[model samples]
Target chain A: MTREHLRILLPVLSLAVLLAAVFYLQPRAMSYFGLNLLFNLAIPVALATIAQMMIIMVNDIDLSIGTFVSFCACVTATLVQDAPLLGYAVLLAAVLVYAGIGAVIHLRGLPAIVVTLGTSFVWGGLAILVLPSPGGASPDWLQSLMKSKPPLVPMAIIAATLIGVLTHLLIKRSSIGVVLQGVGGNERALERAGWSIVRLKALAYGLAGLFGVLAGMALVGLTTSADANIALRYTLLSIAGVILGGGEFTGGRVSPIGAVLGALTLTLAASFLSFLRLSPDWQIGAQGAILILVLAIRLLVTRREAN
Target chain B: MSHITTTTPNRAAGLRDLVQKPWIWAYLAAAAAFGATMVISGGQGAGSLFYAALTFAAFSAIVGVGQMFVITLGPGNVDLSIPASMTLAATLALKFMDSNPSLILPGLMVAIGVGMGCGLFNFALILLLRIPPIIATLSSSFLFQSLAIWSNRGIRVKPPEPLAEFTTGGAVFLPNVALVAILIALAAWVVLERAIVGRWILSIGQNLRAAQLSGVPVNLVRFGVYVASAVLAGVTGFLLASFSGGANLNMGTEYMLMSIAVVVIGGSSIAGGNSNVPGIWGAALFMFLIVSMLNSYGLGAGVRLILTGLIIVTVVAFASKKGYAA
Candidate 1:
């Protein structure tokens, strides 16, 4: 198959395989595990994964992503269902937190991994300071959307698809986005080309921050309340998704759409493992194994290309 | 201004010039403050400063060694798998030894093997598949973390007698761990600085292209440094297990961030060239003091972790940006 054909086919085939596996073996989950619920939970995670993939495409990182999302979720949890208007402030604050992280990385020349890790701690600190527990109610509107049932498909899937499609379009067209790919391809070369590395990086992280805000907004609907560590796992999972979607550090490519599919595959894989009722310890092992396999496959393909 | 020169002899001279440059002192002072806060935080007690400094230096030195190797490889590379390697090594040691005296060396060997295995995994990816060093290490860490948790299944196991400390009816006030850490650091210093292998490793980090042209055995030396780093982390992991006397799944997560912090805060540049044994020792002292001071102050886990994160960023902010191309 051509690269494009395989790219499109992989996600669809994955979904099909997952469906077949679930239907064939997990007949109980089919009845108990509603597709609607899965979509609601998975969409935010999938969106956050895309957010992660975007920054990684530029060869920089957003280690604060997971914590930032949780901070936003805490905001939505505390005020969204209470004051309602305060939700805007929380969302704005979360977005700014990521933007601030970007600015810090730019200004200090500190490794993004270190700088964002600090901000992640700061964000987590703020979250714990605000809501020490997980017991807030979302506004009825938010819950209603999350709990919505569509005639044809779940709104959650629709929302995720819309995000994926829009991102695919935006990244392909924007000059800033083009510049980001160029920088990731060769940072020194890009700097020599008269492009502002600082501005380009800021834009890359800014977009990631926006993704955090979006995931936070979606999450406000998912669980109807925010827990402090809700976004913590996404930090690793997002990177896993990006890599699975064929993203590399010395980057020339990232299939954003493929990233979405990879994320979906990852999420589905987790669900599949949970359904099997194997101990959760196995999940860590499984994740590691899958990543190694994917990376190895990529290595083989690149070797073939070189030959 | 001096004209640009590109000879090996000239480069060595430039390195000597850098050693004497005022930036060296300034850099050392800034690095000292990062550790000093920990010592000063102890409120001037007689032995508190000593204890704080030793602990601070130990952790810093262990982590600094790990970071220094990656930097010595030069390029924008450093290990993120240090925590995973440490945890896996400790967990395996604790689980298998289970307070048995004779099993200590065997356990330590196993732990070192695991560490080396992780490093070899990383080296293979870097050399064979040509993955960026960061990506390679990051991916390998996941494998390491999984193996760590899977190895003991999150159980708290006791260290063998040889590895345990006085607190656990083992040694005197010093603890066997302190000795072990020192020995590892000393041995590493010898292997990485004075040995022929060390020179080859330094060459690879200084300029990979030139090193390759000069037939410095680039891949083998680069691979060996990472392997050595993993073994060092493994020994540290063993000490931590013995000191704490309990092995938990997240046992080494703190070290993951701490080790890098030590290397960066210490004088070792991540852009690889010459090793920074003394700087790593100093950094270990600095980190241990800070953590002990915070512990004395009754800070919670969340606050302690945040403090660590903050210190790391602050350290990076102060350190010279002589990474890559330097």
Candidate 2:
């Protein structure tokens, strides 16, 4: 690989190896859990990571994705009972509503971070309106289907791989992708070039919405019941993954393909923490320490390069 | 740019501004709900709205004002650790009391000191390390939370019985705690408006590089702003502890989003340069009332989050729009 390519792929390779090791050590567990760690906890986490990484790449942030996930989950869980078809419809509708909101905010030329946060509140509010006490139930068969994990290769993992591949294509070869990278690099220069900055931003938000939707879907499956707090941590974890993994690991310009490895690595780390049997307090402390260490290292590396 | 119109904002302009802005409508809506809440909660009087406004106003205003400092003075920078700092300071102060088991007046010193220390901690990380304030504060916040959680271990500490007299069920016109918060607001107004240091803050916020060139002690001002904000948050926490009857680790996290929302919706630009303490105060009352309304509706956590997110988006989006326009 070229040097630039190596910078991107190295992290990816390391994470992939980590995942392999995790699987090897817990092969029985993976199998016992239907051969898909994605269905376990990583799926939602990975999806949230992708959502966050996309926005971070564009040098914007979203504090609302977590709530968005909760909002959609709550709605789906509530609607899923009694009318299975309508529940699916509600799920789709929620996704569209969130996406539409993202698009409007992007088009308005406001900072994505704050706007998304506000929209998150609205969506979360709507979620409360539907099911105030987390009483909704998922269809019994939907849980069975979700938990089944598709014998051939664990469908959720397959789906994630597909997303990673598509993301790879978009970042590497797409026209808007170039525009997005350009905007993040320098907003003024890009705007001066008459590049329709608004459209590009709207598209970025749409990608964020997609990732959030995927995360919500998987999180709903994992919990067997949707609640408001389900994916709240995902917002922080996603951004942390992006920064720690290699997206911001390279000032937010590393390859999208690498992000998958980054996501896997992060999931592995969390699983590792669990494996190590840390208490909840320690887990939180561990997360803080890990972020600080990674950031400190990244800053050191950047300074050395500057030197 | 100019003390957010210090001489009592043009009532006509302010009213005009309110009508034109959706957030004001939101504020009014929140007030209407507060009105309904007062009537339903068995507070039978015209003064109930005013009382409810005062009750919610001070804490939210204090935090909102703190948020204003971080964003405006620091240039769209956020101190995510405000809540953490507030909790740490509040908890530490109360913990100190628990140690000495002080019976009188020690609470004030302990609480304020803890807040200053927390603020000073935030100031050092952001200024000396030159880390982005948001990231630094966020990590510090988590660190603070871990420490708080570890220390508290779900334990709660309450004020001694005598101190409770100053806070709960004692006054109809004004709670003593509310008076303390008002004094804080007055002090902040002086520090951020009339003082030369205040001018330096606004100037730096208006243009950091220029301020640096002008011998404004850039690091000092930057650090001071965060310290100031921390002090405000710390005081808020201490009072909240008293009002709620104690201090706990989880209390401050509740303030983070709502506080930021109150500040942004109050019309301060995220990129900084809007000074209107009264606006911040008014905005806080409205936001608290709004949340209380939502709660009264028996809204679930999901709904609360979504609504908060939505409010944040609309308010900040509008601020950016006005900012760019101006």
Candidate 3:
């Protein structure tokens, strides 16, 4: 295969290998019910990964994505369930805050990592103040929406595919997508070309916030409840997914489809380890090992191509 | 003729410049907070509270020093493994020296050794595999956390007596831990401000390609800083576990952000090429005092976190602007 083909095939190939391994280890996982069980938790993670990918596409990172998602979950579970208007208002405000963060980082020439890191605490604090604890029911509409299963395939798989396609087209096929990538690739050049870098970056962060809210809502829908700290681990998980999907830190290169696949692969890996009855501690270590191994393989492949 | 200047004007400008140093703000803020704390407490039991805050601040300062080292390397360089490594150190120290008090010294050595190993691993991942520092360290942190879990087996162990005594025993005016922290800060000041290696590190941070062309051993200096950071983090973990008399799984989670906050609030540039040893200590103390004062006022954890986050963002934003203006 040519380099371009290999670049596209790498994530797909990894996903296939992971699926094959899981199925071989436990044939039951290949069944419809088992597949549902595995992919059920992946939807939220995929959404979160996509959110992270948006920020990274602009050459920025959002350490607050996880906490922001948790805050959104709190809103969905409590305010949205009780007072729909207030909940929607707060959610909209949160997205605006994300845009403000992007604007501040760009206008002040601040590092995105630190800004997001600082905001993570603020979001977590707000979530805690809102919920105080972890006992809030998701809205009936959301619960029912998440529970709907089609005849042939699971709802989660369908949702993931839809999201993947939509984001891929928005980011890779559209003209605006080229501008966004251009901002990351060469900010000075883009500015000279008369594009507003600040506006583009803020738009990127706004999209991240939108996806973060969707991820939180999806999580609440599946779990039927929300907690201030429910999605705390998603920060690292989302970043890892983006990287595993062939995303670069300083480049605007990213694959929405690959990111979703990466998220699914990670979720499957976690479930697969649990199925084997490995201790949670050991499973965590094993997952890190697996991530390292896959990245190492990709590195070698890239190195060979360079040679 | 253009070089002529008035003597009084020059002196006033000099004074202004001195006052304008970013690190000085941390001291001013810390003093203001402490004064506020004292006034609110009505001077009753303020002494002990002050001492307690200092003792805790010492731990944070030590970790902040390590973080400062990494941040000084360059932009996009960070070590996220510190918390996990510290937890692993505490777990290992407790397990190794549980029954025998005399084993405390050896346990400390072992913890430091683990830190060294972690540092080496991080170096390899960044230099050899070309992984970004944040991701590399974060991945290793997960691995270390898992190891910590496996080692402790869901049990908390009390620190050995000797180690405990070292941390807990001290005069009312100055605790042993506080003293040790000051000494470490002094040592760091000497190395970073007065040593040739410090110059090399700074040069690299300022401009990597320029420093490389100028015959700087970029890799060696970078490696040294990472190792130094890990060692300092390990020492902090050992001290913290001993002071608390026990170790838990989540004991080190807060340290990660807190360390970064200390470094930032101390006026160290997050982008690179600048550091403030005394300022880091002052910032750590300031943060600890704020938390304690909030606790005394019965404020909730949510409020405290929000305040801290706001402080970090505002300080970094303001300080960076001043740096650029200067």
Candidate 4:
């Protein structure tokens, strides 16, 4: 197989193996309810991973996405419940701010990681200011929408499939998608071709912000509440998921379906560990181990390709 | 040509060059923060405040120097595992020492060993697995943090009495921790300015492909830098645990950001290749004083965090612009 095909296939194959392992360990997990329990939280993770993918598409990374999602959750739980229009306006402004940050980063040639690192603090601070102790209630409609069960496949699977297809169409098939990825692949070539790098980067960050906001809302919908530090671990998790889905940190390589599957794999991995009675402390270590193992496999595959 | 002039003119040019240097901003900011704190307190407790700033800033400076070395290696090179390594080293060392005064030396050794292990693992992942340094360090940090939590379950362990006293005590009106950090900074300065290894680092950062072809021993230098960073973090964690009376699971959390902040604010190139030891100290002191000043003004944590983030962005923006101009 070509490298691209392998990249897409690896996540699917691993996810299948992981699913089989989970089913073997707990035969009950084969049921729709068990699947829901396994994959319900995976939606927000997938959303966040897709959001990070957008930033990576522009050869940048958003370290602030976790905190930004937390901030959005705070907005959703409190403001959206009490004042719908004002809350939405605030979220809209946040996406614009993200776009502006992208522009500033490009204009000044500042490191994206450093700049986003700074913004993480800003977002975390804002989240705290919005909801100091995490007691705000999610919107009723959101809660209902998230809790509703569909026929046969469960709501989680339906949502995942919808997200996978929509994002694939938007990011992989669209003309603008090609141009955006081109900016990451070869900035000089695109600039020489009269495409504006600044605009593309801004668009990429804005889309990331939009997805991050959606992820936060979905999380609050599931949990029915929000906290400042709720999604802090999502930053690392999203990056890992993207990589597991065959997304490179540079060169604009990404697969939306693979990313969604990657998120599901991670969620299932956590469930599998819990079923094995692993300590909570070791769960994080297992995450690191999984990342290493996947990367090692990729290394082996690449070496064989080279030979 | 300027050096060939008369000594007086040469000295004047030297002073002028120092003024124009980007590192000057950090010192000026530190001074301004100190001045602001003094004003806020109406001149009361000046010595105590200054001493506290120095003591706290020392930990940041210690870790900041190590981060400086890694960052100086090049873009996309950073040790995100510093905080985790610090926690793990301190936890393991304190557990091994078991608060026994006689085992203090052995405790220090354990901390350093843990640091070296973390660094070696980080490097192995980067080299053997071909993972990017950013992701490698980040993932490794999870393992370190988990090890720390698993080992002690977040229990706070006390240090030996003598060690604690030494860490917290001062000699000649200067904090003992500050003294150690200053000594480390001086050694780092010597290495970066006078050693061939430092030159290799700079050359590699400037252009990796060219440096590799020109025989820079890039991998060895990288190995040394990563190890040095982790070792420093280890030592800092040891002293920090002693000074604070115990080691806690969350003790190293803030330093992750603090280390990087001081490096950038201290006038080091965030893009790598250029750094200065003096800037690290100034920036460290500035960071502590800035927080203290904001606290004295009765600002909430939310406000303080927002302002801190904004100030960091502003400083980085200005530093990058200065880099372009120079």
Backbone collisions counted per model: 12, 18, 0, 0
User: Which wins on DockQ, candidate 1 or candidate 4?
Assistant: 4
**What is the i-RMS of every prediction?**
3.0, 2.9, 1.3, 1.1
Q: Kindly list the per-residue Cα lDDT of model 3 for residues B227-297, writing each as its tens digit.
A: 88888888888889888978778888888888888887888888788877888988898888877776767
**lDDT (tens digit, per residue) of candidate 2 on B165-238:** 66664377775666766777777778777898878888888888888899999788777778778778887877
Q: Which stretches of candidate 2 lie over 4 Å from their true place?
A: A1-39, A80-84, A106-111, A135-163, A187-194, A247-278, B1-44, B74-76, B99-108, B120-130, B169-172, B292-321
- Best-to-worst TM-score order: 4, 3, 1, 2
Q: What is the C-alpha RMSD of each candidate to the true structure, in Å?
A: 5.8, 4.8, 3.9, 2.9
Measured against the true structure, the TM-scores of the candidates, in listed sequence, are: 0.84, 0.83, 0.95, 0.96
> Judged by TM-score relative to the true structure, which candidate is superior, 2 or 3?
3
By DockQ thresholds, what CAPRI class is model 3? medium
List per-prediction Cα lDDT, in the order shown. 0.69, 0.67, 0.85, 0.88
Q: A-chain TM-score per prediction?
A: 0.87, 0.79, 0.97, 0.97
lDDT string for model 3 (A165-229, tens) is: 99989998899987888877899999999999999999999899999999999999999999999
For candidate 4, the TM-score is 0.96
Q: Give me the displacement of residue A55 in model 1, in angstroms.
A: 2.2
Better of 2 and 4 by TM-score: 4
Candidate 3 has which clashing residue pairs, if any? Answer: none
Could you tell me the lDDT of residue A164 within candidate 2? 76
Better of 1 and 3 by DockQ: 3
